[model samples]
Target: MTRLPKPKALLNKQWLVGLLFVPFMAMALPADRQQPIQIDSDTADIDNKKGVSVYRGDVVMTQGTTRITGDVITIYTRDRELTRVIAQGNKARAYYEELQPGEQGIVQAWGNTIRYDVDSDQIELIKNAQLSQKGDTFTGEKIDYNLTLQTVNAKGTPSQGDNGRVQMVIQPRQEKAASTK
Candidate 1:
């Protein structure tokens, strides 16, 4: 059986799993970028000793302009700081809105599971991971996204057979003509 990481290790890097999954620039917005995160759920179980909390039944989390939703969410914290968040569902989803000057866009992601890492600031999407922004979309078995570097990596689960190939859709960039004086 695969052994789980120590609570400390899990708390530190596990969120990387989720953060790497989302390609939406908003999800990777700088630490100082957004407002405090808020979470809502039908039920929650906190284990102070283990530094873990689990939320079930329609979990929704919001921070600044970013939002993430899932059927179940498990959070790991250390010393009152969030370290990791794992969201799971038939189609766990995440959303982020950009309101920067001269920049306006929306990002959406969905997967069987989503993991967010606070320390390293990464996201990992597992099992049918999909991300979309500005009419662009990416789908694969797994996706890793780096919030800080604004980069994404994807992989397919070949062991599962033919449906496991990576797929992407990128829309052409629109150009404006310059007016001659």
Candidate 2:
């Protein structure tokens, strides 16, 4: 005859104590990792507890094709991965651009600077700064780049007459269509 083990012994069993596996857990992982183009700064202070990277003094930060240069650049991280980067420019301008893997271009911007936090997953464009992409340009008091959603937002007074404050012009790769003419 065999005797059943006590509750304490059964609870302590190694096999029973193994990690639980759930198929649904895979959905929790992120799809794309964060990769910046360039990070330039005179100083960089990292805080693991807060999961933030702060760069000061002539800081220029870029990710992939995006380029950001400012007096201060901050990078935010969550789960040991970088989530967002914000560049705070001086009287000078900061830059950011979205491009295909091999595409490259210059993104001109200027303002009080930029601040991005990982927890919020936002790229904040602030101050009297401006943002531009290709031929499109916008000048706003503040903007947010939502990484998760892959979208950009703007909020501020626009440039007069020219709509300098809020401008969006997507360049058409319409050469194929034009060739038919």
Candidate 3:
């Protein structure tokens, strides 16, 4: 009689409030937050009286676990909230997956331009900005993140003469050795 298996349930905060959460205060999305904002585009343009919405070819967006791809994506809302969201592309990318209480994984970014600011949750990556988590990485031409103060601000643009300079790759933290039964 040996059967022990039941440990798979983490990722919360409503999928980090649709990814990384602007300011990530438990992953934003208030105002009764309803979720559901899937978008796929080959071409799209909506301007409900200038609320603004434009998606160009090869764009992809999700609203729950935060997934973003791009060729172009621009969304800006006002009274309805959602301040801004712009994603351009050559490599604009984004992803999300979070778990606290002991930490989990997944959080990525890449850019040719990727800005997402809901009031001020902030998430701006420009030029060749790159960001990662868990495995640690941070390259830059510009990268600003503050999803709930996880904090990060990188920049590099001396005309990119030497390819600028703002690169990081920290990944050395593994301490778990205390089990004696």
Candidate 4:
């Protein structure tokens, strides 16, 4: 059996708390939500009655700095407003990336399937889910991230490789040098 790192040895509790809460406090740029969404794909099928649209063949969707790319993407709208987005990957993993508020850098996620709910401000990654920000990484079978709550929940499935354990890698913060007076 593989040994897991002790909680105390894994990461600094205070730093871990801040790592999980601080940067994600503003998961995306405030203006991103206000920006108009743009999508590009080889083909698109829209069903006005159902308020559903499906795009196939290298679909790319963007709103400000937030971008999602996949082999197929489905968008759901309600009353002309976007309600949800689902992306499924065939040749490659579905990918999502967005610039965080301030200079926190970009957050990126990848999985076989990605689901984003606009109302709840949540993103769910299923199957080979992996998320990373500022060099820290999280990997598991499934990951649910709530932007508003700044929380993350991950589930792992037993397999040959990882032994059904979620993995996290937290990088040490770099200290700035003092200026000479």
What does candidate 3's lDDT look like per residue over 55-111, in tens digits? Answer: 888888777656677888898988766688888886434433223322434567887
lDDT for model 2 comes to 0.54
lDDT of 1 by residue, 79-152 (tens): 87778888888544543233322343666677788888878878788887987777767788988777667777
Order of candidate numbers by TM-score, starting with the best = 4, 1, 2, 3
Quick one: best lDDT, which candidate?
4
Q: Model 2, 1-181: lDDT tens per residue?
A: 5644347565444222221211111111132235633667778898999988888888766555455677777787778777677666665665544442222234444567666555665557776656554554545576655545545565556344333334344444335544553
User: What are the clashing pairs of model 3?
Assistant: 22-121, 23-121, 23-148
Assess the local accuracy of residue 4 in candidate 1 as a C-alpha lDDT between 0 and 100. Answer: 41
lDDT of 1 at 134: 71
Q: Write candidate 4's Cα lDDT for 59-79 as tens digits.
A: 999999999999999999999
Answer with 2 or 3, whichever has the higher TM-score: 2
Q: By lDDT, rank the candidates, best first.
A: 4, 1, 3, 2
Q: Which 10-residue window in model 1 sums to the lowest lDDT?
A: 95-104
Give the Cα error of residue 137 in candidate 2, in Å. Answer: 1.7
What lDDT would candidate 1 get against the real structure? 0.69
lDDT measured at residue 164 in model 3 versus the true structure, 0 to 100: 74
